[model samples]
Target: MLIKRVFNNNVALTEDLDHTEMVVMGKGLAFQKRPGDEIDTEKIEKTFITPSEGFANKLSELLDEIPYEIMVLAKDIIEMATSELNTELNDSLYLSLADHIHFALTRLKDGIPIKNALMWEVQKFYKDEYQVARKVLELIEARTGQRLPEDESASIALHLFNARQDCSRMEETVKMTAIVGDISDIVKYHYSINFDVESMNYSRFITHLRYFAYRMLRGELNDDQNDMLYEQVKMQYPEAFECSRKVQAYLEREYQMQMTKDELAYFMIHIQRVTSREKS
Candidate 1:
């Protein structure tokens, strides 16, 4: 591949056989190199071939400033998150996450730590994404030997959440987080138990809440009142059903969103799983 532009000693813009521009990274891949020079393919560590030229330019600019190791680390995190979440992520995640991490490190190094106000919501709502964010911070510490605070995890989770949605905005992500946190709080208070947040039951509950919040945000109402499982759950787990009723009321009041019987039935099962004496 011929170098189209050299971002740094470690990264450069190159074109493929199809004449498509790609950002390629390696250790000293561009050292003593100029445009049109052949890239050392053996030293190539990663390549980004974006569909949009503007995005490619932005990515090229980001690669020019951020260190190659950090970029690679962010890419790995995005790949892992995509697999774990089973979602198709936008390529813009490369730019957004890398830029965020780069600036976060700079601020932390300067003794300026920003607190994430949405930390509680993110932990309660986007549990899997938050876990991935924590792993990202660990990777950053491992690679650069700088430890960031817990608040960074929430910010990273937002970026991951945004990447998964086709029309996601930061405000919408915040709303979803808030909704999940509120419903979880209602369930906890109604049950009067401290949940094992690390348990599989908690993970499953948060996953359901996330999707439910998504549906609510999109205003996609499904009133399936004839669900066969509703009566059984209402009869078997009276307490859980009562808690679900509170959750339903909260949604109705706060977001002007009504819960369908089918949704309430699913909520009962999740609440039961998490609030059971065995799990608690």
Candidate 2:
């Protein structure tokens, strides 16, 4: 590949045969190199193919700011997450994760640690992602010799979780997490029961809440008028139905998003399963 730009001695921007921009990385790969110079394929350690010019620009800017090691660490973590999670993540994760870890390390070095408020919720609700994040923390510590606070795991988990979704903004993920926690709280209080987070029913409930929150944020309302099924569920599981109503009210009051009867019916089904399992 011919170099279009050089960010540093170890990184350069190049284009493939299709004229797609890619950031190539290696030790001393760009040393004494100029734009239009041919890249040494043997020295190349990693290449990030930019899907868009906007993304390429943003990534180029980020590369100039953060340490190359941070970029590599983020790449390794993302690769591990992809293998462990068995999912294709958005390419933007490379930029966001590298930026986050760079700042997080800087904050720790300056003794300005940030607390993740959703730590408990993230750990309980996103077990698989959280586990991968914990492993990431260990990886970070091993590479940098900086042991970040446990809360950082939740933050990393959020990044991993957001990477799996269709949403591009981290704010949406945070909001969805908060909504899930709030709805879970409403169910707990309404039924006077604590959820067994390890239970299959509880896992199903959390998954339902996550999708519900996603739909709510996107304004993808369930408009199907399943009146008969709704009434049948309401009568069959009266207590859980009441709890779902409370959750519906909470969402409406707090988020100003109305839940449809179809959503309510499905919500009631999950609630009934979880609460019944908890009681038994």
Candidate 3:
């Protein structure tokens, strides 16, 4: 395949089956490469589109900057999943998720499905994208006629960790807080922990989601909130109260947890906010 563009020392762009630009991640494909560089087809493992049509020139101008190939592929994966699912993902997330995907694909390929500390919350909160994730599993299965590895499902779910329909960063962070906060609440309620969300720990807890959401923005992944988040979820939130009951039941039954009250509230709030902002 022709090296359409070189993103970095380890990543290059080439033509995909759809005759569109896509990035391929592997070794030696990008070293000492120019725009018209020729790459061996065998070295091209996975190829997918890029947010930048001008990656070559853009990358060159950046000089000291080089993008992580795996992350670039992850961004491409998100684009693929969203397009396949007929869901529109925010473009900003492209840069962020791409980076996260690079780290995740390693763990995923090695058979660890959930790598981040907040993975359980990610699975619970990003339910809609789970449909997109499930499609990734199916896509892999169709290619091999064998079930895709479970970690691939986690890779896709991690896509949800960075998934967003809103391009607004502020709205994105707030809504993510709602989404993850609700997930944390559900888990806490299920375990019947002596929760107290009113304490500052609630703020600390939400901050973790905010930071994870921030990492998505920075195109880096730094997950510290593990099964050891020394925090609590309050039982007193009005919307949180409703989601509390519903998710509690859902968790006990081994079924998918629906969006909790806080999630829906923030979701609708941000949806309206983003739409109105876009319209205005």
Local error of candidate 1 at residue 251 (angstroms):
9.3
Best candidate according to TM-score: 2
On residues 48-162, what C-alpha lDDT tens digit does candidate 2 reach at each position? Answer: 7876678767877897799999998998999999999988777789999999999999999999988875676576556788999999999999999999999999989888887
Candidate 1 lDDT over 134-223, as tens digits, reads 888888898889999999999999899878855467787898899899989998888777778887778768867886788679775455
The number of clashing residue pairs in model 3 is 4
Q: 1-280, model 3: which lDDT tens digit per residue?
A: 5677676666777764476776676766688988776777776655545666565454444323424543444555666777765756654455545444444445456866553444344555555566677675665455435454554555567555455554346866675566566656564554456445464444445544464445444544433343222112232233443444554464445423343334434333322222232234
Please identify which of the two predictions, 2 or 3, would achieve the higher lDDT against the true structure: 2
**Candidate whose lDDT is highest:** 2
At residue 169, what lDDT does model 1 achieve?
75
**Candidate 2 residue-pair clash tally:** 0
Question: What total of clashing residue pairs does each candidate reach?
Answer: 0, 0, 4
Per-candidate TM-score against the hidden true structure: 0.61, 0.64, 0.38
Clashing pairs in 3: 22-48, 23-48, 71-98, 197-234
Model 2 deviation from native, Cα RMSD in Å: 11.1
- Position 133, candidate 1: lDDT: 85
For candidate 1, give the lDDT of residue 61: 77
